[model samples]
Target: MGVKKTVFKTFKFILKNRLLFFLILLILLGALSYYYSENYYLHEEDPSSENFLLNYPDGHVVSLEGWVVDVYPGGFKLYIYHHGKDTIFDVRSNTNVSVGDNVFVKGNLDDEKIITAKKVVLKQYWMYIFLLARSALAILIVIILLLRYWKFHLENWEIVRRK
Candidate 1:
């Protein structure tokens, strides 16, 4: 059979078993929500709070304490102190922080090999769009799965009468 026909056949089978399909879907979505919520809650941690520091290992923890220096077109840079040493860290261009605002950043030190920010506390607007898109996709998948189940039941009844 062609690829399209094979896919249709599989979909038909899934639709015919609506209860099973829905149950599996519920489990999948629940797991996804749980995972995403964990990551989302982590974003709420306060960098300036002493309570936050207790969670991270000493050497791995980096604390940047300074006022926002320059808000360039690309990104904002902060001048901070590290054990009497001064250093500059750049927040990506799209961050919502303004110049001259005091802030603290708590993050791990990525070795100088290739710098990558695992988690950035500063406001980034595009994250909302990404989250919305994910929600839309999950909704669409559930709707399609339900429609397939209905189609399978209708087709199955038709086949029985023909026989």
Candidate 2:
């Protein structure tokens, strides 16, 4: 009798505040969508062009990630020594990259083997930091909402399931 009463009370509390439930669901969905878009749906322009490769056999579209050696309004130059070639990429863009910062670039190479950057990814490390912060925020919100409306609080190892 006591278990039945407890279950009934819990169900009543949750069902009475459908709006809160919806809000929690929406926030969880938002966090999930954010992860999805970053991981799966992100699209970047292909730097490889047949014209560039054909016209200049020495240079073509390449993806390079290296330390920024110099910066200018029009573009920045990078130095990659990983392949032991000590290759220099003179990318064309006024990106936020500064000297010594590691960056990823996708661009076409000119006759001189300089890459004219089509896209630049800066501070790749920050992406992971932002993801963690965003997920933590979403979880915190769900916990708060659950405590307020459902009269339920989660511990470190609690699991939630819905009927």
Candidate 3:
């Protein structure tokens, strides 16, 4: 009886706050995706003309730079070309790499000669830097907005006039 009433009350409260729950869920999902994309996602990278994968055997750390020629989505396989040599790079997830985009690949080659990319960074450093700066600015703006939104609610009730 008591437990049932408490459960019903809790359910009703939750139902009344569905919008807040959904907002939290949306924020969580966005944060998770950003975390994965920034830290876990293997982005393709291209550097200078030096071959970072030269003479590297299996299980050895190989770093290479080349243009992304093809990408097989959902398979984590990317076909990159360096000096006319086709190199197979395996990413962790579906990497957004376009053809002719310069990228740097760092990983170890398995027994099958496929480069398992641990970190695939793009050659364009300035672009990523710009993006990071923009993200910081946006975060600052959100913080300011939240501060302003809550600032008006705080009150000091210490002042009083007596006759």
Cα displacement (Å) at residue 39, model 3: 34
Q: Rate the local accuracy (lDDT) of all candidates.
A: 0.56, 0.68, 0.61
Give me the overall lDDT of model 1: 0.56
What is candidate 2's CA lDDT for residue 51?
Answer: 29
- In the order shown, the candidates' Cα RMSDs to the true structure are 13.8, 12.5, 13.9
Better candidate by TM-score, 1 or 3: 3
Those runs of model 1 whose alpha carbons end farther than 4 Å from true positions after fitting are 1-63, 107-163
Model 3 worst lDDT window (10 residues): 41-50
Candidate 2, residue 109: the lDDT equals 66
TM values, all candidates: 0.29, 0.40, 0.35
lDDT of 3 by residue, 1-163 (tens): 9999999998787677867767878999999999876764244343222234354456756666655556676424555565566666655434566655566667666654466677777744456567789999999999887665544423652333331
